[model samples]
Target: MGTKPKTRFGVIFEGAKRELFSVRELDNGDLSIFFKAPPFYDFLDGRSEKTLEHRYSFHRSLNSTPPAITLMRTVALEGGQIIRTSQLRWRAGESFSTMVFARACPTLRPEHYIMKERPKDTVILLYPIDIGRTTLFYHVVVTDTSLDPVIFRRSGLWVTSETFGHFKLVVLSGFFLILPFHRGFVSHAMTSKMRVDGQEIGADLPPIDLGNVSPERLLIDIGRMTTLLAEGLAERHISYIREQRYAERFVTETRQLLSLRPVPTPPDLPRR
Candidate 1:
């Protein structure tokens, strides 16, 4: 008897099941998230590009009104033997819960995947992937028994949290949020008591009063707030050396595997 050969799907699933990101905390109370480019999904966007490195920052939202973190994605690309960088901003909504928000893996429980009547197609798995010591996250995966890879017809809701708990800030919803006042937040909502999942992480922020607003003197107040943003966090400069090394090693190995696969080029487009 001989062992079965590993398929491309098996290799992908193995790598996908592992922890995919590294994390650390910055001196300025910001969280840093580091991840590698997808091994299987090489063409993240439409181009002959592959990712080299990624530097993500979960910092204070400059907008302030949303009570979300500034999710900045900085990726280094290698295309045509030329290295370039790209950047973008996203928001990780504040939700401070460690329950089903993360860590819902079948390996931990085993009983969850043993349901008799539950449809396999409907089974969605969310596992807690420890990127670093600072925070935890849910890695979404779908149940698949076949060797063929299939796309899961679902989108993810990115609910993130800080070490202590959720932010006690109110995010104004709907069209009213488009208004310029209160940094796009409703003034009354900012001072209102809003709790997330009944967990109060921090003290409520007082109403931000811009006393007798004048356009000329606004720069003074903005300067003070900018200085305040740089204050140190309780856990300053936490490192994720081990996780970082793991992701880097995975990336190197994936690149090796990718080199073995031939990339298709169109006749109209010249190869780089």
Candidate 2:
């Protein structure tokens, strides 16, 4: 709330990091944050795994001529999963249950209700982030007209403690349904602890040190964004509720009219 948070932007291409970026190396054979390629990987591991430590190998290749460091948040689960504000079905509006659901689904669903299947270039309107000095493309081309939703595992957000972001305009190419992507953060101190307990091999810079995460300064910004989104969702829910109530009221108001207007009789049919 007081001062601005520091941030920088970079794209992470999971697993394909070495295949995409030209990792930087120091004279002593250590990797620097800068790279000539995109990065892929999550930041906060689901169970605190070494998803980030292994990224050091991206620089070890020395020959990896395509990418940059990976900073992933929530990893994808088995099948298609997403964090979405849209409820697939009617909600009971139970308070406790809503909070529980929100806790599990922190991010919005990447399932975009976009175009009818076609080869087109779509843009990810990056909010709270600016891709400066990087060659990453904001436009994602959907080349396949008849294919499943393409998960761009090769590109991920360079999340930082000082930044918070959301893609206002989004698409996963072919299919709107995409795999689950959890978004969360890991404490720097906890990450250090992971290294000593026979884990976190090939130590290197923390994500903050790497300068990959891009976010707006001030934690308050994130809170504000969350509040705005919640309020918008609440308004929509209320509107739906009103629609349902209106229908119920209309039925009640017309019931007496229907009852008084009549019981039709089948007169004159006896002539037949």
Prediction-by-prediction clash tally: 0, 26
**lDDT (Cα) of model 2:** 0.23
How well is each residue in 46-118 modelled by candidate 1, as lDDT tens digits?
5445656554444565566544443344545554232222121223342221110012111211221122221
143, model 1: CA deviation in Å?
Answer: 28
Native-vs-model 1 lDDT? 0.27
TM-score of 1: 0.26
- Runs in model 1 lying further than 4 Å from the true structure: 1-17, 39-46, 61-69, 79-272
TM-scores of the models, in the order given: 0.26, 0.19
Runs of candidate 2 exceeding 4 Å displacement: 1-69, 73-216, 245-272
User: RMSDs, each prediction?
Assistant: 22.6, 23.6
